[model samples]
Target: MRHTWRWFGPVDKVSVREAAQAGAQGIVSSLHHVPTGTAWTTEEVEKRQQEVRAGGLEWELVESIPVSESIKTMSGDWKAHIAAWQQSLRVLAKAGISTVCYNFMPVLDWTRTDLRWETPIGARAMRFDLIDFVAFDLHMLQRPNARAEFSAAVIEQADARFRAMSDEKKAALSRNIGAGLPGSSDGYSIGELTEALGRYAAIDAGRLRKNLIHFLSEVVPVAEELGMRLCAHGDDPPWPLLGLPRILSTEADYLEVLRGVDSMANGVTFCTGSLGVRPDNDLPAMLRRLAPKIHFFHLRNVRREEERMPCSFFEAEHLEGNTDMVAVIAAIVAEEKRRKAEGRSDHQIFMRPDHGQEILEDITRGAQPGYPAIGRLKGLAELRGIERTLSHASYGLA
Candidate 1:
């Protein structure tokens, strides 16, 4: 696997040179300044490429070209947005970039209730506390039918939790959940969130799935023609949130997507942390089954607080969470061998240390949440060690 690091363009606190210094061979980036629904110009693509090249690293993949809300909902100006997306892909291919990753989660991107939950070792990691989320949903956002979504026991717990919070904590919780992540297109105020939720009133899981298929059916051919791979990222929590449908959460969901598109150009971005949040997902088995269609990997892990649905989880160390990191890497190594034996061109996959805790100098640096420098470097070193050991011992690869 090619080691890559995600870098937000010029504005990011973590520079491209820093990513290179941390041992990343490539940079995963996007034209974040380009607004959603706008076609990317060749100049912009080349400019970002130049920035990455200046750091002595290549821009390997586009972390995302934000899928516009119109395209996801198939609402106002949806066709135009699709055209722009295709245009962006063409521009990227013209610039010598082949792999792209995007997601279809409604309203928000990857979210967490706490951005700096201090671990026992004094490192700060992101966390998603179920009780806190429920409290926000019921008392803060006050979405209709929100109470019905939770069990009576959970509702009681949420009420108590909400009551115990001071006004400052309440505001912080709302900001953490409603405000979008680093590269997300836009964040929502409370009223804006409610309005966005209303747009999806008629769209359920089935309808959303169809919309995604329609998108792939339209865009996958363009990608195929250009010999580019378009990988859909899995939902962050791997479950529905704010009553929105989460279609790309499980193995069955991915199978349905692959079947729906039925093209190598349409693929999956295998993210261990996201999918591993669900206990039933057998990571190694799923990797083996979907190896042929997986074009990108986010190798991270999370520790689940409970065994039940809607349970809370915190980002754990790469090898310390519920996921069997050794087994997962072994499966990947085996898949690479199979692809090589088959004489396939895309034999080596692109992977990154998805997220890391804030440790050491990371605490004072104020790097993007879950994207600290030393933290990710530590993760990359650990992952590289595992991959090398597995390749030499089991797969017999140099």
Candidate 2:
């Protein structure tokens, strides 16, 4: 794929121009200031595209459209919200921005409990350690099913872990998970988290999937008309646990959603990091099977630990993760070649080093993920070497 860096627009510590200078040809971004369920106008889309283009970079992917709560809950004004979403897609299409990336992770977008995860290189990376997450959910937030979310054995494990953690450690984990993404719908206090889980207590996995399909069925045709394509990311570990509903958890789940809408406009964002957390994902094979369906890619790595409950534990480290980065990149290259052979006009897929550490120079100051110069430069360097070497040497011994 084409090299794209994640840009959070002008307000981002890392600007679009900076990304251009970072050897990036494209910028994967969103109108983060736009609240969920709001209609983004053609003017708004054009302005953002112009800004990116002015920075000497192409606006390659809209990282998300931010699915609304009503749309997710299938409640009041949902149809109107879906229509607004369709309108936003048309607006982008009119502006000639064809690629859009979105995720269906409920409430929070890619939740993590620790922003200062450790790496062997003496650099601290952001991670979603399961024990840290569980401690926050059960003890800090005190969500009703939080305790039950952890398996019985794991609950005991978590109790010991929580007891062992100092007041400072628990405080950090709570802040980390709740600091919230820049433009998240609502910031959760511990109280809100409890209430939110209870609200979702009624919407099971099946209902959530149905809502997703219904939302897709409604707007995918609009995507087709605009010649716009969406890269819908799957919900990690889709099982209904602790009353949290999951729509796109498995390969079958993905297939069901895809088959429901059945549109070229409807596609998936294949984040190797998210899927790689599960050993069963089989990254290389997933590429072969889902090649035709993936519209964008998030290439990163994660190590899986099966012992953790709710989510089998995973840690993000570009090279060390369970997802075979080498094979995954090779499959990506092959897919691009296949697309080219099939006469596809879509440009190379957009990718970013999903999340990076608050490292060396950055640790003393800054948010956890947004602008990590050292870690991401290292990650991009590694991936660049991987891509170039693989392009030269078929599949092995490169």
Candidate 3:
């Protein structure tokens, strides 16, 4: 696997130089300033490339070219957005970037209730507390029919949780849940969220899946012609949220999309942290089965707070979470060997330490939540160590 780091460009708290120092051989980034539905110009693409090159690293993949809400719903300007997306791909391919990662989750990119949940070891990690999320949806955003979505027990728990919070806490919780992640264009105010949710009133999982397939049908061919890989990231938390359908949450969902498009360019970005949120998504087994279509890896772990669906979870230490990191890494190494024996040029997958706990000087730096420099460095070191051990000739695992 090629080690890569996600950089949010020039304004990011962590610099590209720091990424290089953290031992990243390449970068996974996007032109975030380019608004959704707009085509990226070659000048903008080359500007970022020059920045990454100056740091002595290559821009290996685009973390995303944001899929606009218009395209997702097939609504106003949807066709135009598709054309713009195709244009962006042409520009990227011209600039020599071959892999692009994107997600189709509507309304929000990735939702989290707490950006600084304290861990037992005195580090800060991101968390998704189901009760807190329910409370926000019920009392804060007040989405219609939200009560029907939760079980009676969960509703009761959420009611109590909501009542116990002070006004400041309530506001913070709202901001954390509604505001989007660091490089995402989908952040929303409560009013904005309500309006967005209304647009999806008629679209369920099946329709959303069809929309995704339609999207792939339009864009995947361009990617294939460009010798580029378009990998769809699994839905974060791997479930529905805010009354919106999540079409890419399970193995079945991935199979549907892959089979729907039926091309090597139409692939999945095997994100263990997102898919692992569900108890049934056997990471190693899934990796082996989807080896051919898996194009990128986000190797982070989560410790589920409960066994039930819609359960709470926190980002745990890389090797300390519920995931069997060793088994997953071994599978990755084995797949690389198989690809080598097959003489495939796109054999080595690009991976990054997804979200790391905030620790050490990271506590004071106020780095992007879940993207603390030292914490990710710690994760990359551990992951690299495991890959080396598995690939060692004595182990015969590679």
Best by lDDT: 3
CA deviation > 4 Å runs, candidate 1: 393-398
Residue 336 in model 1: lDDT: 88
Off by over 4 Å in 3: none
Which residue pairs in candidate 2 have backbone atoms (N, alpha carbon, C) closer than 3 angstroms, thus clashing?
A: 302-321
lDDT of 3 by residue, 139-230 (tens): 99998899998899999999999999999988888888887646754577888889999999999999999999999999999999999999
Q: Who is ahead in lDDT, 1 or 3?
A: 3
Residue-pair clashes per candidate: 0, 1, 0
lDDT tens readout by residue for model 1, 203-250: 998998899999989999999999999999999898889999999999
TM-score of every candidate relative to the true structure: 0.98, 0.91, 0.99
* Candidate 2 residue lDDT tens string, 153-262: 66777777888999999777766665545444356666666665666768877888898898888888888888888878876543443357777766777888889888
After superposition on all C-alphas, the RMSD of every candidate to the true structure, in Å, is 1.1, 2.6, 0.9
Per-residue error (Å), model 2, residue 352: 2.3
* Residue 395 local lDDT, model 3: 100
